[model samples]
Target: MIDSIIFLIKTAFKNVFKNWLLTIASISILSVCLIVLGSVMLIVGNINLFIDEIGDESQIVLFIEEDLTVDEITQISDRLHSISNIGNINYKSNSMILEEYKESLGEDAWLFEDLDAETFRNSFVFNIKDLEKYDQTIYEVEKIDGIAKIKERRDVIERIVDIKDVLTFLSFWIVMIFVIISMVIITNSVKVSVYAKKQEIWLMKYVGATDAFIEAPYFMEGIIIGLTAGFIAIISQIYVYNNVLSPILSDLGFINPLNIDSVMSVIVIGFLVAGAIIGTIGSAYPVKKYLNV
Candidate 1:
């Protein structure tokens, strides 16, 4: 068993090296496919992060009419609290709103010197627990008598959600196309290696060598090609994400990019597993035809 294993390993390495050009081509194509997959995954992950961040900060502001009495305001607050979808609710008085506006103005505070605190209506700022209920929540809030206006960025959130869906769809088809291409390339490469050693394969079969023994080397060759490509893809992905993409994204104040360290293990494991599966399928496909001999 040890000798057979050694022979299989040696034969696999020899076949891979013997067809170096085809091996290189196969690796190149597979690497490009993996890189594309990795990039799409990273983008999707960051977009998800951004979406969650937006969700956390997403708030509906209800501007209350100045004429409402304290009891009316309390009633409105109680009504808002009763809503199943509402998360945290905070009341901001007119004076507090004026103070926020002043802080926003910064050096241009003089421009708003004549602005009276009463110009700003008291408002309740609250987050929604479920974005899907956004419209219904708004309808409920609008029905309240004390509210003068309802402010929200529903349009923006909807657009972001749409973008995420589109990207996910595109990435799925794109990765599938690349996977098919990679398999075809690997199949052809393995076919060449098998053809090159046909005479030896025939003799081994004539000596009663099992089909499994004969097919093992080619199978290993495919795995080696896939692993090489996967390793290269991983390296390229790390360099580009850490040295290029991460830096650019980190500079953007609003984007909270995921740390590469947090996800590195996942990426590595995913790529390696994907590579092994692709390699096994690609090699096994062509080797079957030769098995009948």
Candidate 2:
């Protein structure tokens, strides 16, 4: 069994080298496909991270009417607390708002030194636990009496959500398209190698060689090509993501991109597994058609 395995490995390597051009073509095609797929996955992942950051930081501010009674304020607080999706509700007095505004102004704060603190309204500022319920929460808050105006970043959130959805859809189709393309290219590559040694395969079969024996080397050839392509793709992806994309995104100010360390394992394992599966299927399909002998 050990000798048979060694023989298979040596034969696989010989076949791969003998068809070096086809192997190179297959590897190049698959590497490009995997790189594109990895990039799309990274972009989608960062977009998701950005969405979560936005959701966590997102707040709705309800400015209160100046003439509201203490009882009305208490009732408003009670109503807000009763909402299932609301989280971390806090009331900021006009004075607190003024102080915060001053802090935000930094060196320019003196320009507003004479400004009346009462110019800012007392407001209920809170986060939503479920952004999907944001519109409903806003509608419920609007029905409350003491709220004079509502301030929210809903427009921005909605736009981001739309972009995420569009990208997710595109990524799914892109993966499907590339998988098909890779399989076809790989299948043709294996077919050419198999065709080159058809007479030898027929003689081996005539001498009682099993189908598995005849097919093992070709399958190994496909797997080696896939593994080489996957490795190259991974290196290229890491370089582009860490050196090129990460710097550009970090400079964007608003984006909080994920660190490569956080997702490196996932990318590596996913690409390798996907490549192996594609290679196996590509090699198996072509070899089966020629094995009737």
Give the best candidate by lDDT: 1
Q: Lowest summed lDDT over 10 consecutive residues: which window, candidate 2?
A: 284-293
Q: Residue by residue across 112-136, what tens digits does model 2's lDDT show?
A: 8998988999899998776667788
Tens digits of per-residue lDDT for model 1, 6-119 = 999999999999999999999999988898888888978887788767877888889989899999999999999988888889999999988888899899988888889888
Give the lDDT of residue 128 in candidate 1: 75
Q: What is the C-alpha lDDT of each candidate?
A: 0.88, 0.87
Tell me the lDDT of model 2 at 254.
Answer: 78
Those runs of model 1 whose alpha carbons end farther than 4 Å from true positions after fitting are 62-124, 128-151, 247-257
Q: Candidate 1 — which pairs collide? A: none
In model 2, pairs of residues that clash are none
Off by over 4 Å in 2: 62-124, 129-154, 251-253
Task: Judge candidate 2 at residue 10 and give its lDDT.
Answer: 95
How well does each candidate superpose onto the true structure, as a TM-score?
Answer: 0.73, 0.74
**What lDDT score goes with residue 64 in model 2?**
92
